[model samples]
Target chain A: MKEFNLIQRYFTPASLAPDTLLGVGDDAAIIQPPAHQHLAVCVDTLVAGVHFPKDTHPRDIGHKALAVNLSDLAAMAATPRWATLALTLPEHDDTWLTAFADGFHTLAREHGVDLIGGDTTRGPLTITVQVMGHVPPDQALRRDGARPGDHILVTSTLGDAALALAQWDHPNPAPTLRARLTRPTPRIAAGHILRGRAHAGIDISDGLVQDLGHVLKASGMGATLQAGALPLSEAFRHAMGDGTNWQYPLAGGDDYELLFTLGEADVEPIREQLAGQGCPATVIGRIEAEPGLRVLGPDGAPLTLEQGGYSHFGN
Target chain B: MKEFNLIQRYFTPASLAPDTLLGVGDDAAIIQPPAHQHLAVCVDTLVAGVHFPKDTHPRDIGHKALAVNLSDLAAMAATPRWATLALTLPEHDDTWLTAFADGFHTLAREHGVDLIGGDTTRGPLTITVQVMGHVPPDQALRRDGARPGDHILVTSTLGDAALALAQWDHPNPAPTLRARLTRPTPRIAAGHILRGRAHAGIDISDGLVQDLGHVLKASGMGATLQAGALPLSEAFRHAMGDGTNWQYPLAGGDDYELLFTLGEADVEPIREQLAGQGCPATVIGRIEAEPGLRVLGPDGAPLTLEQGGYSHFGN
Candidate 1:
């Protein structure tokens, strides 16, 4: 398809607000936030062979790139409003572009975010998405606000993505396990719920232990995760026997769930509200005065893992 | 240099502003914009084989990737404040990473932009940068504001980068020509000068004519270009005989210069101010009440040539 044709067919959806002075057809997009809202911006990139397996579906690739960035907005306790996509492709295959846009637009619209601006270039199969969300300046949650007495909570089960990845290399894994790796849902609503209440927050891209380590480092505090309180999906348990699954839960990447800290007094009400919305909430840890992350195993001693979570360069 | 070590050494420069609440080392950077200013954001990616040659210098790749995005910010007349880099490499090579960061940091620091947050992944070599700048809500330039009879102006000489690129496959034409392709000077100062004066603008990434095509299409107007007025760098002229250089001037990509439109009344004063600042400004076209771009060759007939721009899917 031609460039303008590709834009009209896959972009320029009504989900975008008219407040956007300029969107996809220019050098860059122009947007103005509502009077009381501050813009929360972040970018993430996914390469063909690096972020996902080479054989992964194009639709999933599109979903995950935007999903990972939405996860960033979630960590900030912001409401995602708009996004710009920078896509570098080997060639313009109409079918691939369509499926990719389908995946991206469906999720963007569902989250009430619009595709505002982007650039398409001829290059390798790489997708970079910059997401912008709106938050009242005072209510935007960040990783620097955790206090020693705060309660650390995580949304939904962990390790399913990592476990699913392990089974991904297998020729045939169960359908459920495959979908977990292919299309993990980002907890958007849970983030909105925690916006005003969370003291600090972050999305788990590089496993719970490593990602939480970032929050601890930023907040200048420590954390102790309760091993028994960790939530695991059935798919996670099936891939790694009960005990082994804990390692993946703590170190496996690509969960896209929010790990946030809230004031101890606010947990009960927040948890009830989240439960009302049919989202999972678990108090897995607590913030501490010190500055290192530790995990207490089921036996109540520090759990030692062979390696830390996935690093870009690999541990 | 390992990923973390490289980040700490090269990427973690002190922020220029006190309001920079967060700089690198976190999942995302945080900053409080001045109360009166709005944020302008843009992202651009350069792949090794597609955007540049496979064996292109890492330093040049780093410079161009950031320069291109900065050019976008410049088009919007935004003062760049922060950037996030996402690099995907095939392996963990110390030399390459060090040089890449060195090139990136040098330009970033010069522009007062800090590397706030980023992700490093293992894959084919690709660099994606998302840059954010500050623009007063009422002062940001856009591509849709050009009115009929506006004078279209461009900064510096055009077609040098394209000529330099053409020389790439052959022999190095000259040091001046080579530098044009290898090191692009984003029109930051010129953009700042034209901020409130220009009615609309866009950086010329896809050749002067094609990019201006975007401005015209968006403004719902037409343009008439003076072929003789196309600015030619000394190196471009040396490479192209005066008559033939028109092709390069009109169609070469990678120039990263600002092509903007100003009201007829503001032209003389803006030009005088820019001249005082030691920047060259050229008025080569005029926005018309009609609705298509027309180029008048030396003979004053409509000029039509093959499309001279790059598109993601267009060959």
Candidate 2:
């Protein structure tokens, strides 16, 4: 199919948000955002070999591309509204585009995100998604708000996505773990519940340690993690086979979980609230008066990690 | 520098919009858009070889990437406010980045646009810019409002960029034409002026004939162009060094001028208004009750176009 036809057939139909004053088909889309709300915007890019392994399924690629961007909204405690996609493809394959559109629209519809506007081109496979959301004034979660002595917490399990990646070359990886890796859920609802509760929040796209380090740097604070307290799922254990491999979850990237910090006093009630929303929360550590992150072993001894988290550039 | 460090040094500094409640450092940028206005959003991508010749100056690449997106806002008669840059590079090149950022910020500062948020990755070189703008409610120019008796107009001149491209292999191309090809200006001022004066508007990115067809299709109208009325620039004429080479302007593209349709009686005043803004407008045609675009030659006979315009798919 031609580029214009492909978009008209697959994308134009899905851009039906009532607040979208103007959707696809124009040079730019016009949106009438609700009054008294600030707009939150972000953009993310995924390269075939660099971000994901080559030859990944088109559906998975589409899902993960938008999923990672939506995760940013979840981190900001904003409600996702609209997304624009820029896709560069090596070739035009109807089957690939059909499945990719299915994957993208499925996730977008769930979050009420409308396909507002975008551009398509001929090049190496790369997907860039810019998502816009709305957050009530003074209600957005920020990385700069982590106070010393605050309790650090995370939503859902960690390390499963990383472990699933490790099993990529295996003959048969656990379905649950693989889903965690390729179809990682964005914790939007958890974000909403934690909006007024959490002091700071960040999505763990680049591992828990590295991403949390951002919150620490932004807040000018430190943190101490209880390694045993990190949530590990049964699927992760099955994928790893034997001993504890905290490194995979702690330092491995693409987890897409929420790593947040809250006041010491507000933790229990917020935990209950999130659990009621089907997103259980776990207390991992506490923000410290010092200026670096440290993880304590089960015996309460300091555990040294080879690296904090993944970096596109070697640290 | 690492990806994070590169962004901090080069990108974070460009985010200075006071209305940008949150800028580059956060999970996503937050902006308190002025109340009572609609948000205009647009995205565009530039691939290394496909969008431009390989090894084009990084500054020109950056300028065009943002310029193209800004052009979309111009077409919509919107005031650009913020932009997110998603850059993919094969490797870290500090000098290239410095030049690119200089070029990007030069235009951004001119338009009061801030670089809010983005992602960087290692991959084939690509730059995707998503621009957000604002237009007052009921004041946006749309493509669907052209009338049968409306006059079609284009800002500045057409075909210079396309003509410059035709001279790409020439040893001594006109510097003026070269600049038009490399740095086509977005007629934002013209668009703003036409917000209320024009019935419909669009940018001439995809050749005049084809792009105007979109306006016609959207407005459910047809048009007739007096071939002698097509605006031709002296630089384009100097580049071509021939008589009546109308194809370059009529079917060639990368012209970021605002092509708008207006009521016949309103054309002269609007043209005078645009001229006062230093963007002279030209009346090129008129909307008709017919259902297809027709161009009349000096001989008063309809001319046949070999092709309507450039398409990603071969015609």
Candidate 3:
């Protein structure tokens, strides 16, 4: 297969946005950004064996590659408008390329994101996606805006993806847990709802404690997380019946849920708004003037954690 | 080294663009696109052993990674602005990373481009760069804009990089030819000069014939090239004394020169304009109403090319 033929066959999906002046088959994609909006740009790379199991499905790889980048836009309260993919593969497999394109385009169409441009090369399996979106300049959620006494909230649940990884060698892993690992949802609509409301925001891709610590450090504040208030999915709870695997939620990575901060008065309203969208928002911590992260157990005593988070280089 | 520490220490160069509202350390980098301009977005991936030799210098790899994407922008006649990188490496080597960053930042600083956001992962070495620039919506040089009888032109010379690659294992490759291979300049200034003047444009990354074929196909036209008119650098001419290696310029890849078409009347003015900027432009072909590309030898006889261009998957 020629590089041009491969791209035209698998990657050049029709544009969905009117602002895309030119899409694929050009030197670069030309886009007209809507006036009064700031462009939010992000890039993420997922390497085989490091980010996913080597045997992971090509469809899942495609889905997760875009999902993680969209999660970043969600944290910024940006509406994803376009994405460019740089895909590296060891060999040309027709079935794999078809499935990968299907997975990528399925999510892209769902989010109204145009597959504007991309580069496909031959190498070890590595997928890099750069997503571009827009948000009102003043309303863009940032990590440096958290204030003292603000409430730290999270969308949906965590630990399912981590649990899926831990049980990968099991005879039968739960489909719900495995799905969380392969197809984590980006809280884009929830991000839009949080715009102009949340003081600070970040996507929990690197565990709750580690990602929240970033917010605290960036905003020059501290946080007290209530371990009892941490949200867990039904499947997660059932899988870990004794609740001994708290580290999966607290320190394990790859959740893709939004962790955000807001004032106490707006919590109920924001929660209700998110509930209307079929997503639940839970208050698990509060920002403090002191400058360190603390986790409180159900008995109201500080609990120390053994691990910080998943670091790419730490291992 | 932790991922965050690695990013902070090596990749987080301070912003040089005021419009970069929020840079690295955020969920996404935020930038205000100047009003009345369309954004040009492009991405390119370079794999070790595929795009460059396994032993290529880290600095040249970094420079070329960004340069190739900038060449895409140049072909679109866009002014470079911001870039996001997604790098995959097998491990952390401080010396390699520092040299790579120096190379990337050197070109970036020279072009007034800001490093806005990026991701670093552990894998076989691969670099993907996404560059965003601004071009007026009406003035972008696109491939589909050529007309019959438009004179085809190219900036600087070609075949030097191809020659250098052929002599890579030699004990002493010509320094000029090696630099052309390792540090091919993007015709950004020449692109600016071609905007609103050139009817169709493309960057010659995948050989002159293949890339020019793109322009012809997009414009629904053809071209006739004169073999004697193809520009050759002093290094290239001296290296190939008898000029038997015509395939090096016609079918060899990695030249990064701008290939464009303009009216015959505007040819001299455009060539003079480019020459004033220290880049020479040569008229090598003319667009034709007929629908196939043809190359003429020195005796006015047609010449056949043995190869098309570089293809990632063809091998």
Which residue pairs collide in model 1, if any? Answer: none
TM-score of chain A of 2: 0.96
Poorest 10 consecutive residues by lDDT, candidate 1 chain A: A1-10
Cα lDDT of model 3 by residue, B69-153, tens digit: 9999999999999998888888999999999998899898888889888888888889999999999878898999999999999
- Ranking of candidates on DockQ, top first: 3, 2, 1
Worst 10 residues of 2 chain A by lDDT: A1-10
DockQ of each: 0.38, 0.62, 0.66
Lowest lDDT sum, 10 consecutive residues, model 3 chain A, at: A1-10
Candidate 1 lDDT over residue span B1-315, tens digit each: 012434655567755566566566544455665665766777777777767778778888778878888888888888888787777778877787777777787899889887777766677777778887778776777888889989999888888877877778775467787787778887778888988889999888778888888888778999999988888877677667645657788887887888889887888898888778776889998999899889998788888878757776654
Question: Candidate 2, residues B216-252: lDDT per residue as tens digits?
Answer: 9999999999888877887766656657677878888
Give interface RMSD for all predictions: 4.3, 3.3, 3.1
User: What is the CA-based DockQ of model 1?
Assistant: 0.38
**Chain A fold similarity by TM-score, each prediction:** 0.93, 0.96, 0.97
Error of 1 at A34 (Å): 3.8
Clashing pairs in 2: none
Q: Is candidate 1 or candidate 3 better by TM-score?
A: 3
Return whichever of 1 and 2 wins on lDDT.
Answer: 2
